[model samples]
Target: MSHAFLKIYNNKRNKNFFYKKQIIYIKNIIQLLIIICIMHNFWMEWNNFKKNKNISISHIIINGKKHYSNDEYIKKTISKILTTNNFFKLNLTIIKQHIKLIPWIQKIKIHKYWPNILKIYLTEYEPYAKWNENSFINKNGDIFILPKIYLEKTVNLTFFGPLNSQLKILTMYHTMQNELKKYNFFIYSIRMSRRESWQLILTNTIELKIGTKDIKKRLNRFIKIYPILKKKNKKHIKYIDLRYTNGVAVG
Candidate 1:
């Protein structure tokens, strides 16, 4: 009976020791986990604070003319984006994206001015030329639909082509305009056909047809002979075809 009691006592003591060790290990692990989480959270908060230290925008300034762009429209767009924005503590990328959605904005630069002011520098799209009856194109050959306020504005140089052909046509138009400027004949519009043929209408309602091949050469030839044609014939000539290699045909 004494031996059995001793054996039972030893087994109970061993079990107690094993349970104590497990409990201590679990407690230590939980404490370590809590300390790690606290450190991580502290680091995250510190980083956030560093990135956005300055808060509160005192004044907002726009530095540019509002010619093609609507002032109220721009202000409304900014107000929508700046709900939680402070001058220096803003998500600049998001702000820029929102600003760019205003269409008329060609480019924009935004930054905080000292203590509590935000300044935005803007470059708006000027109406370089008209694309058609309703839209306008900038100097870079990008077409945009202008507001009704600017729809009736005077834009003499118009361009027409297939949807993706604006850039090419604009380039050719510029070149031809330079050649025609000496005679005081500014180009009113240029159209490129599907066959790559070019037709230009002058401001005085005269048309020039430059066929697909050797366009510049034929145009130069016609320009050379245009003075003689005007002096020889004062009659109304509708269109001048510069496709012939040796001579030009007039209608």
Candidate 2:
């Protein structure tokens, strides 16, 4: 009888232990559910706050060299974008795309200040020379075009060359100009033919026919002979042919 009683006590003890373990697991699950509900409520409240806050952009500051009268247009564009978008969700890439539509602007930087301010920085292309007939070349050899009004006001040496030769022509022009400047000579225009032959018109209206090969050597030859030619009444000299190996032909 004692053994049977002990067996019943062991069964009760095992059942009590199993029940305690199940209770602990259920309590943990309940706590996890409560924490998850609290997180969900907090997220919803934060989103609601963002939606209801007044984060509209009220001030826009443009900072850069205003080389052209395009500030009004830029301000108009920014104002149009603000009409449909909130400051907190402004798409800077979109703004940049719109701003780049202006032809003269070379580089741009956009910034956003806290709550209600937007800032823009701009850099305009500095026109270095006239390219072909309708475009301008910057000091960096980049080609761009401006309106007729702006172009009329610009006075620069014109460069003519085959298509896609802006950088080559600009580089050669600078090299030749530096060499010529040592002798007080100034170039008014430069032209490169489709055959790659180069030529220049001096500011004094004299033309230089520089053939394709050995161009710099030929230029040096001309520089060597220029003093003697100037002594013989420079007004009578129309053109100088620098294509020969041992001598130059004057026209």
Candidate 3:
């Protein structure tokens, strides 16, 4: 081969080798960066796992302890169905449902304090009056099963109505009760009939048949003339029928 041609060939071969080395170096650098990125992500995940591993339910506090519910029972129930034994991993929705099943529990709020504590705030139903033998009406007019211990005690303003009629009956009872209290008249049992008529019996066993129509008006009329009627014939009347428009029919 000629020296000039050989020299040119050698130079081209060296150039090709240099270009190959540069490509390999760049590939190695890219692989190292990828490895570093992978290691960084793995380390972050490992650190998170280590932190979560130590999280657990260390403390539980329940507020509003009265009447039917207490802390131990609530904690016991929450422990049973809690998705994770760890307080940090507990599902609030599931715990809320379990807690709300406690009788008379009206409203509840749950909060998770980080690192191992949980707080439960509970609000129970407010009992307005007694319904039937073993149930009570809340101030919101919702009926709840009364604890048996309360059934024996005399409940003020005894009420009876269709299950759906609780709100209506309760409202009517309150209105009449306040008005009647002025005349020293007290209701023994107020019942709403199937026909939607209302009749209330007094503590003295005298029934006031204030039918469906003009019920409030009839009650007011009875209250207005109660003193005169009681004086004239306290024991003479069997039942006072306020269904009459012109005058109260005495039965």
Candidate 4:
């Protein structure tokens, strides 16, 4: 073929290839726009479904052992949120935050039933003993505060200790109570001084002075001698000093 003919053929082929590429790009853009429109419509429908009044929560069932807190108080706490929000869109985190504001509530579990029911399972702290003046200690050694109205119903055993010593004091109280119970002696109060010294007041108002070191050993020794002391005018005993290395000193 002639050189001029070959150049013209090449130019025409290149233009056809460019046109095909542009067509493919335009098709891809159209497909992308179609996908975006479908997603936008789906999102709008989803939002409308969530906001529909038919799915709004109508019944809330609270199941738990109520001690200091009643169902009425809990219902009142989350009433505003429950009234305004849809069940499908209700946030469990928000509900948990509201319930936690009540001091008596220890742990909570929330579940949403299909359609319009919300169930909440609650666990309240069991007050095992009174701590210091204003707080109570649970069986798990956790300290919590309660309203003045509920304080009157608190356990008779009172524990006094420094800050951050709740677990230590609570554990000691349990150990001492177990040992004392064998002798029919019940502890009314326990106090831990700044120096870490321990003291106990029995139900009969008899005081026990337990020094800082070797507390368990000293207590064991005292327990061994308690029966003999009871035989000798126990009513006259005001305080028993168990800090000695050999025998206890009774006052």
What would the per-residue lDDT of candidate 2 be over residues 54-85, giving only the tens digit for each residue? 56777888889877747778989777787678
lDDT of each: 0.80, 0.86, 0.81, 0.87
The reply for model 2, stretches above 4 Å from the true place, is 1-55, 234-236, 246-251
Model 3: per-residue Cα lDDT over 165-187, one tens digit each: 88888788888888888878888
Model 1, position 62, has a per-residue lDDT of 82
- Model 4 RMSD vs true structure: 9.0
**Cα-based RMSD of candidate 3:** 9.1
Please identify which of the two predictions, 2 or 4, would achieve the higher TM-score against the true structure. 2
How high is the lDDT of residue 25 in model 1?
Answer: 100
The TM-scores of all predictions, comma-separated, are 0.66, 0.72, 0.68, 0.70
Candidate No. with top lDDT: 4
The best-first sequence of candidates by TM-score reads: 2, 4, 3, 1
Q: Rank the candidates by lDDT, best first.
A: 4, 2, 3, 1
Candidate 1 vs candidate 4, lDDT winner? 4
RMSD in Å for all candidates: 12.0, 7.9, 9.1, 9.0
Cα shift from native, residue 63, model 1 (Å): 1.4
The residue pairs found clashing in candidate 2 are none
Q: Whose lDDT is higher: candidate 1's or candidate 3's?
A: 3
